[model samples]
Target: MASPVLLCVGLSHREVPIAVREQVAVSADDLPEKLRRLKAIPGVREAFLVSTCNRLEIFSVADSRTVADDLLREVGPAGAPHAVVRSDDDALTHLFRVAASLDSMVVGEAQILGQIKDAHETAKLHGAAGAYFARLMAKAQSAAKRVRTETQIARGAVSVASVAVQLARKVLGNLAGRTVLLVGAGEMAQLAARELHQSSASELLVANRSSARAEEIAREVAGVAVNLAELPALLERADVVLCSTGAREPVVTHEMMVRALKARRYRPAFLIDLALPRNVEPSVNELENVYVYDMDDLERVAAGNRELREQEVARAEEIVREELAALRKADRERSAVPVLARLREHAHGVAKSEVERTLAQLAALDEKQKKAVQAMASAIVNKLLHGPTSRLREEQGGPLAEAAAELFGLAEGPGADPVANPVANPPEGEAADVLPISGRK
Candidate 1:
């Protein structure tokens, strides 16, 4: 679809805040609806969206270079700062890195591969992804698989939940006899529950606004379900708090925690706020004997995890670069394909017409004579095409190529313009950082 150019416009953990990222994130349940809207946008011939909590990425192909802005505009993430837009080769490279998990905040995480696959499948199911994206996604997945298979990129603390649990152990020394309170029942909270169970935390308490939802997660982790109203009491007794609620505002504020601490006589509590907008208040960290860890705090642990996996990262990068080079070379080589096909088709057509005419005029000829004439005609066609075919292919996208097409009338054929540039940068956007580089070429 479109120019066969790959374009990716996205805001990631690199620059965008959690607040803005959440606004554009498309979840698994919301993917199909979002994909339909993305396809309906003008200038976008093919499209798919990958919106994880950490990022909101739009991948598309279009005729004009300005499509990136149109894409972001269509997605309604306008005025969001630090969006990176790439086209063709760079865009593909970015995708490859993302699939390989090299672009993740926690560089060797394994969950991103599954997420990317889900996006690819969603696009295909909705008919938004065509031959180009299909092939590209497949190749990207293959490379990611290879990276994981050949390197140790996914060795430690692969998910945010796991990292949060690991850090809790460091602060508490041992989780075996500790009471771990989970303030929400989201995926992250469930994962934390599982981690706590594995760490042999003595008592686990799950508190949610919906008692049924809390009960469900509690059953899964063999923990007890407590009502949301019991949060203050649970907070007083709990040694560790993992909060991951979907609430828009802070659930555990400074004022609330101050009351909880008074009940505990100011005993130390370790808190991990995994919610995007943050469930725990930032000011709560100032409380004596209370330690607060947000996503950004967990990020520091992820940075350390990345450091430990540096060797694996290097290997993964090399593999990604290798795959990228092959893709680029293949793209460049395909430019000559259309012209060669047109040349062959034209020659075959002429040879068939002449052979039919000759056979009709020489009706007196025997069966053997007709066969012999057919063989000669085939040979003539082959000989006639050999020289010009070789020359035109070698002169792809130049004056000589244009001249050859005009001389042979192959210019009228659908495949004549075989070597058009797949990417172009439009000058409509003044923000060079956010605009696609295709327009610059």
Candidate 2:
């Protein structure tokens, strides 16, 4: 029997705060690099990385827990003690819940599902994802679409982006004549740009290391594009700065921002640093007339969204529970394959031994008579074993499967004889070997 191809070991908003998640969230552009590092681990076979402001997770299929450990190690300080792990059916349930935004700070937020899709695609392009992961993600995505369409989950309260925009409206009263400067061309920045544009902001500037990408996003939003070299100058002129670049280090350091603040004569600047590892420096918050809001600060805004959608959240949770139960049931069924194989081998071996014994006892009989006796014994053996065989087959995929397999000596070997084929039987009473993420058994 093959090992389960479902495993998830990583942290998120619930387990760790934004401070830790920011360090680990693989940026969209460099996600392939992170995926490569994860796959290079010994046990990992197929892998996908889903990274968002709310969570950073690695979904994979592996032979042992070591693969998950290796991923955490490779992610360095970013994945440390904060990263949580799950395996088999639990991992599948986690992915489904994540896609449905049931695992989000604000439940039913739709942005995460799209981020997961993008992450899966990025992994696919790099050969990090295989057939199993692709199928799993497809199923999860399908489930998310179903929940969104079938229920009120996505009707009244839609997305984190929209919620952020709503908060901005409440804060500044009006966006007219305000200048919004987007620090990166990433998805979060783009979403913010869309919101700002829709609110009829007077001007927009997109600054990025890749001027072409900046220009690309800028054109879409009817904004101007600037190089990273020009951000210092642009920062002084903008009223709102949404920073979400891919730099490992802080792109908007406190000192540099202080200089920009001085240039603007300490005027109030609404800064939303939406990057993980945070694009803006934490110290920048101390500056007067500079209101800096990162993901952590957004929790207050998320809480507001949560309170608004309290009634709808119950429905989403119910849907997630139903889906998770079905997935767990399916997993238990797959886990029973080894026991069924073992039972079949044991029955065949006993029948063979009985035939040999009866043949020796009937040596004095004629050849025809001996053959008749052997055939009769064979039929009787088969009939006697029929009930157990049927039961094993029928119970292969239910809740009782694992306990039942352990109770029978049926889970003993790879072949008919346990002594002769010890390797086939998993270490006495141990579970069968599962396939690792490395694609080897």
Among the numbered candidates, top lDDT falls to 1
Give the TM-score of each candidate: 0.81, 0.77
The count of backbone overlaps in candidate 1 is 5
Q: Write the per-residue lDDT of candidate 2 for residues 244-358, one digit (tens) a residue.
A: 8777888888888899999999878878888877888888989887878887677767777777776777777677767655554454445556566665566667877887887
Can you give the lDDT of residue 38 in candidate 2? 77
lDDT of 1 by residue, 245-355 (tens): 877789998988898899989877899887766789889999998899886677778888888888889999999989876665555445456656777787888888899
Query: Model 2, poorest ten-residue lDDT window?
Result: 416-425
List the candidate 2 regions with Cα displacement exceeding 4 Å: 1-7, 27-37, 40-47, 60-71, 87-90, 118-135, 156-158, 253-267, 335-345, 356-375, 393-408, 412-441
RMSD of each: 5.0, 6.4
lDDT of 1 at 254: 93
In order of listing, the candidates' clash counts read: 5, 10
lDDT of 2 at 395: 67
- Give the clashing pairs for model 2: 22-277, 44-437, 44-438, 45-437, 45-438, 62-436, 62-437, 63-436, 333-397, 414-424
